[model samples]
Target: MSIPRDTRATVTEFLDRLAAGDPDRVAELFAEPVDWQLSWPDEGHPAIPWIRPRSTRAEVADHFRALAEHHVPERNATTVSAIVVEGGNAVLLGRIGQTARATGRSYTAMFALHLTVENGLITRYHIYEDSLSVAAALTAAPTG
Candidate 1:
């Protein structure tokens, strides 16, 4: 199925809101009871277990909030490189740069966000990023 123009617009608008640091606008793009998953490449363990999936908008919001609180004093800055929409799905390739308030560390990492839209709202999303780099930035030794 091909993506509808309106759906594409919605996806673009959502990304714009995210890049603009407007959480409320971002929330408006999500369908009620949204499912969000954040996955990282695990180098350890036999199964290489990834972080548990998060379902529900509130849970997703809390996850993002925690990440923001850990990384940025106010909010993390997101930069989008490209967006591809097909059917009810959209793929966003981007980079995120932030300075951790607690550790005063800086980090920049690439990310890919896959989203599923239903009724002009995002119902499901999966975020992939360089977890190790992000962790290091958020927990590294402070620089003078």
Candidate 2:
């Protein structure tokens, strides 16, 4: 479905601010009591120390902080490949490029994000990415 101009603009700004790596500004685009989910299994959580489901806006900022602590993000500017809007929800197609801080190994993968935006504020965020690829990079964090 075609994305509305307003919603597209909102998501674009959200993505832009996210890529800028300012957690506080990124959190501002989210609604209070934000719902955040990472598409990783329970058993796989330990390997990826930074990724976990978050329920609050403060938790969301912490999540990004944790990510920065573990990985040096190379995708300072992430490209939004596609945007699909359904009602108040939008799916964003993109990728993240990063280097594991401990191992200095590059980890890059395509990603899909499901976002629920109401009144231009994101209320729900569910991200799906290749776990095996992500975990591999995460594993080397400790050894390297």
Candidate 3:
């Protein structure tokens, strides 16, 4: 099934803004008090600084900022293989490769992102990723 025009547009804009690596611009596409959810334990893993609760658009920007700070910009890569849309929802299936700056370890993980848009703004942002791989990469000892 085809996606609605407005939802498709919003998703496209979000992808563009995310690619540009502008946290503020990326957050601009989201509505205030977004329903943010990530696939991780509730104990709040301290290894990954970006893993935190985000509600407001400003917090959304902060999430991206923290992510950028912890990961190597030159080594990070994201590939979206598919996007399935229905009504106001869209799910992006992709793989992400990232290198931890401190540990200098790299990990590749498959990810699925579910987004829900309302009135041209994203109201929900839920991501399911290989958190174990990411955590290992971030916390592992740096190799010589």
Across 1-144, the per-residue lDDT of candidate 1 in tens digits comes to 222336688787776766566455566677777776676543332211224455555555555555555666455566789988888888989998888776778778899999988877788888888877667765667777
lDDT of 3 by residue, 1-144 (tens): 122248888899889888888998888888888999999976658888788888999999999988899988999788999999899999999999989998999999999999999988899999999999999999999967
Tell me each candidate's RMSD, in Å, in order.
5.5, 4.4, 3.6
lDDT of 3: 0.90
The 10 consecutive residues of candidate 2 with the worst lDDT sum are 1-10
Quote the positional error of residue 127 for candidate 1 in Å.
1.0
Candidate 2 residue-wise lDDT, 1-144, digit = tens: 222246666788887777778887777777788887788875447857767667777878887878888887753334678899887889989877777776767777889999998877888999988777777877773653
TM-score leaderboard ranking: 3, 2, 1
Go through the candidates in order and give each one's C-alpha lDDT. Answer: 0.69, 0.76, 0.90
- Model 2 misplaced stretches (Cα beyond 4 Å): 1-5, 74-78, 141-144
Clashing pairs in 3: none
Q: Is candidate 2 or candidate 3 better by lDDT?
A: 3
For lDDT, candidate 1 versus 2, the one ahead is 2
